[model samples]
Target: MFAKTTTSLFTLALAALSAQAIITPTSPDSNTVVKVGEKINALWTVDSTDNWNDVEIQLMTGDNLQMVPLATVATGIDGTKVASYSFDAPDVSPYSKIYFLQFTNGGATTNVTWTTRFTIAGADGSTTEPENSTVYSGQTVQWGTGTLLSSVTTDGSSNSTSSSNSTSDATSGGASASTASTSVSMSDSASSSDSSTSATSESSTSASASGSRTAAGASAASASASSSNSNSGAGQVTVGLGMVGVASLVGLIMAL
Candidate 1:
């Protein structure tokens, strides 16, 4: 009877150990921030004695007694070979400080492991602060609908494109203004140079005209002086000839 009781006690202990969780979740811890529609990996390490061949990953919320299943992350994961399960995070509303991942052995609810609480952000990069104090009427926490990450990324890219276009337009406008200013400056300089050249030409022409007038006046005075000298010589010659002829006529009458 003692041997039978001892064998029964050992068998019960072995059964209890088998029912305990052999999977240990390692990721999606307190510091993890999961985005909606983003790929997330639920990483874990399994005990060497694990006998489970398949597993199911679930997104859970609330305390242990009132735990709520938010979504099924993955099912039929090969527990024997895969230490992690990858899935797209559901489009669930931002939940702060109360979200965790639960891994269950295939067909056994008792054999399960849970990761530490993590945050889920919306597609608009919206998230609540950790340790939120909002009051809840029930023990179960529910996630509302949220936008997808793809939509947010596309919107951000569009805004960036618009900003680049605006900057390019501004730069082009500035360049045109600068070019206009330079053209105006060059035109003003050219006008000033033309005015200076015209003034110099006029001064040269006036000087040339004054010099010609002075030369003409000198030539006329020289011609007048030569004509006066010629007339004076002719008058002296005529007076001398008349005086000699009269002297000759007086001498001949004395001889007779």
Candidate 2:
């Protein structure tokens, strides 16, 4: 009886860890925001974890309605290993997007999303940044929906907004970021949430953009609306947009 009980407990613990199915790309996260029509190269670490399945990079842009599978590989190093993935620049346009890594092995599945950002341009485009929040279009950030730790970790505390606009950062699908307390500091299950958040922050800082502010907002809103359903945690956190910039632009625009 003792033996059986111990085995059961061990099995349960393993299952808990296994429940976290994922394909976490360690590079090119959403926290960073880039301009339109520029070369968008995303580097990610793919780890599908369950007995080897197809590892893939799924890029969702033009606000979720557009999904393109940039890369995939079947054979891997082991049940848990690291592999680098790079997605070539997408078609030029003025839009925002999000990204995620997926792992599928028969009946099992796992996914990890970065707090990232992206942008496409119509012309040479331009990035209009407000010098001060008090100015018109001077950085009036709008938050949206998507309930969860994203708010807490992203901003240290979760924030919510009433704006129904698709671009509201709180919404699920796109670049609109929801506000959180800015207190937590991406400290969840390290390998999963916490680590991903940190990686996203590094990427967001390097993002280079060139274009109009209004254009960015419109694109972000459209993506958020389209991504509303497909994404599990949609429109929950109310991250301020203009008043404050995104905390971390994850590797590849995990937000879009």
Candidate 3:
């Protein structure tokens, strides 16, 4: 009977140990910033004999004093006492919010949660302070929808006007540049035409001089030919007269 009673007490103690789950975070302290999807280690303790074969680790965040599960961590192991897990944070909005880890057994008993008030930085580890209201207070209040709408409209109109002015300035500058380029091209073309015209005039003047010289040379040759023809006629007439005179002298000799 004593053995049975001792065994019952030991079993009760073991059950109590299995019913409780404790988790403590060693990284990302209170009011500290940690990047989303950053790996962090956590320490947990659980009952070993209870065979609490599973435990789901989750990131908890929310407002109104009610924390909600934001992300779940796949630790991939049965809950073990004094074990460490590298938890990858979720990619959530950067806010100065209460971040915590919740370790719960697989329907074995009540769970344990540890809260760490932390800020979520950017992916590049760049930190930004939370809004003024969210900095010190836990409650989050936002501006009214109508006020936001009016501000957005005003900003949009101003941006549109600025963009239109910039575009107009750019277009005007481009047009001025195009006009300058066209003027330069026209000037070049005119210069080329003037050079062509001068060359043609010079060529024409050379042709005219050559033609005059040819005509003058032809006239001189014709004059020389006329003079030669007249000389030849006079010589022929003189020879005929000499032949007649010789024949008359021979007749006189014969008569004598």
Ranking by lDDT: 1, 3, 2
**Which regions in candidate 2 have their CA more than 4 angstroms from the true location?**
1-7, 35-39, 45-49, 62-82, 97-115, 121-256
Q: Where does the lowest 10-residue lDDT sum fall in candidate 1?
A: 146-155
TM-scores for every predicted model: 0.45, 0.32, 0.38
Q: Kindly indicate the candidate among 1 and 3 with the higher TM-score.
A: 1
TM-score computed on alpha carbons, candidate 2:
0.32
Model 1 lDDT per residue over 66-164, tens place: 677776656676776778766665665444556788887774687777887777777675787544333367543433322222222222244669999
Candidate 3 per-residue lDDT over residues 1-256, each given as its tens digit: 9999999999999788655534444545564566766655655555576454566666665542455665565433566554666644455554344455666665332565554556655578765443423322665532110001011112224466999999999999999999999999999999999999999999999999999999999999999999899999999999999999999999999999
Best by TM-score: 1
Ranked candidates, highest TM-score first: 1, 3, 2
lDDT of 1 at 144: 32
Cα deviation of 121, candidate 2, in Å = 4.7
Give the 10-residue window scoring lowest on summed lDDT in candidate 3. Answer: 143-152
Q: Give me the displacement of residue 184 in model 3, in angstroms.
A: 2.2
lDDT of 2 by residue, 1-256 (tens): 9999999999999897777655454445545444433334444444454434444334432122233433332223243454443333333322333333343443232443432434332234543332222222464422111111111111101121334443454455432232232223343344567567877876665453333455688899889877875463433333345224444555337877
TM-score of 1: 0.45
lDDT of each: 0.71, 0.41, 0.61
| lDDT for predicted candidate 2 compared with the true structure | 0.41
